[model samples]
Target: MLSEGQRIAGQYTVERYLGRGAFAEVYRVRHRFLGRQAMKVFKHVGSRAAAEELLEEAVLLSRIGHPNIVRVFDAGIAETPGGRSAFFTMEYVPAGNLEQYWAARGDRFTRIGEAVDLLIQICDGLAVAHGERPPIVHRDLTPQNVLVGFDDDGRPRVRVSDFGLAKRTDAFTGLASARGTLAFKSPEALRYRKGDSPAGDVWAVGAIAYLLLTDTLPFHDDSSPVAFFGVPRDAPPPSPQIRNPEVDDELARTVLHALEPNPARRAADAAELARLLRGWRNPETRQ
Candidate 1:
């Protein structure tokens, strides 16, 4: 097997394992011609039909192009090192996922305005995905799947990643086959509710907003780690000000609204949420 720093496909050099999901493994790689990029190699699909499904996801991501979404540049079930596994190449942001970025900060979110700006961009991107003709629901939206990088102004730029479990809301009418981080999951998701719609992604964005402002997750793992894994959550509204009181109330309220137990009460979609953050002013200070 190719280890860290080894080259695969005779052109791309693997930097390291960035992460692994249920269906695949992600690697930080530098393409000889493309430079730095991320490569997601799926485990053998086990059947021709399954392989077609994985390739379809690649096609779905390629067709749904958005600025804040990770761009998939190349994809094929090429035969090379590591055998006949399927893989797709995408842009690699050096900053890694939001979780690592937050942890490196000593569990503190910096530059309130910058963090909000990042969240707004994410909202716009997700909105584009959800607004597709039939709508696309990112069944799994969490810090681990969201990436953060810096802009020319050194501002934070957020990107959504990992679509292995994504689905078309217009066609899917049953409980999501995929689940994300327990704490960031929507209440309906906990209930195995059917329908993969924009609402679940809204709830996820809300959880991320809360995490970016506060170091802790809105849902607590009070039980033993093993037990907690199975324990259902009654997520509470997390106070961003608990760690940094500097967070604006309007911003905090927006986050809380996204996380409300009643999915029906959540923001309609990413666009609505983005509108709330547009020209954001500290509502608490305005009065």
Candidate 2:
């Protein structure tokens, strides 16, 4: 583990530890000249083959450049007495992730309009990835992967992060099989049938919207830590309005539409979903 105050690549000065997952450890660091940043370094050091696999994440981040996506400032191999480790520096989102943002808000649900706007922001980022030549599908789309921050104007901003599970649409079969958190996965993904599609990502968007509105997952399987592990959420979940009466029918309908099990029937893509959210109107507020 890289300790606080450790310097990597002779440029970034480690400020403190941020997070750690099975594959990597993230540190909050300050570049000698670039200010504050988040640095992610692979945990394991072994075969050159393993290093290449881990480097793919940095490559993906470098390729997908969008304001709504986490920006990769630099990437390189760091040499230490132990060995060489691959690392990348990205924008440091101080507000943490969507999951943390939502949890801190207490029992009160985020305003319907605010939640819809946040979802639209997420869709904007997804649209960029889905628009690529071969289309990059983020097999994993959870609140944990959505970073929340503030812009220069001090307004809330969102950026999609963690592309480790992302892959080109054409190669989905080989890479995305049985990936992603079970709760956020589309039914098709759960069934391991064409699991990495724009439609599958759309489903995750719906699940996120549902969670934001109700503070509950669309489907849950208490029998296992993995929600809906083997059980398909064949039945449509009760409307988000059931939990938060403030969730109007228009918003509830949009969310449920995205959760549709049939990929063909869901929103055409993230762009389409964004449009729906943008067009949503509260009839009660009509003039």
Best by the TM-score measure: 2
Residues 37-125, candidate 2: write the lDDT tens digits.
99988877766676667888888878878888999998877864457777889999999999998787676575777778789889999
RMSD of each: 3.7, 3.0
TM-score of each: 0.84, 0.91
The lDDT of each candidate is: 0.74, 0.82
Runs with alpha carbons beyond 4 Å of true place in candidate 2: 80-82, 171-176, 222-230, 281-287
Model 1 TM-score? 0.84
| Native-referenced Cα lDDT, model 2 | 0.82
Clashing pairs in 1: none
Q: Judged by lDDT, which candidate is best?
A: 2
Over the stretch 251-277, how does candidate 1's per-residue lDDT look in tens digits?
A: 777788887777677787788778777
Task: Score residue 241 of candidate 2 by CA lDDT.
Answer: 92
- Lowest lDDT sum, 10 consecutive residues, model 1, at 222-231
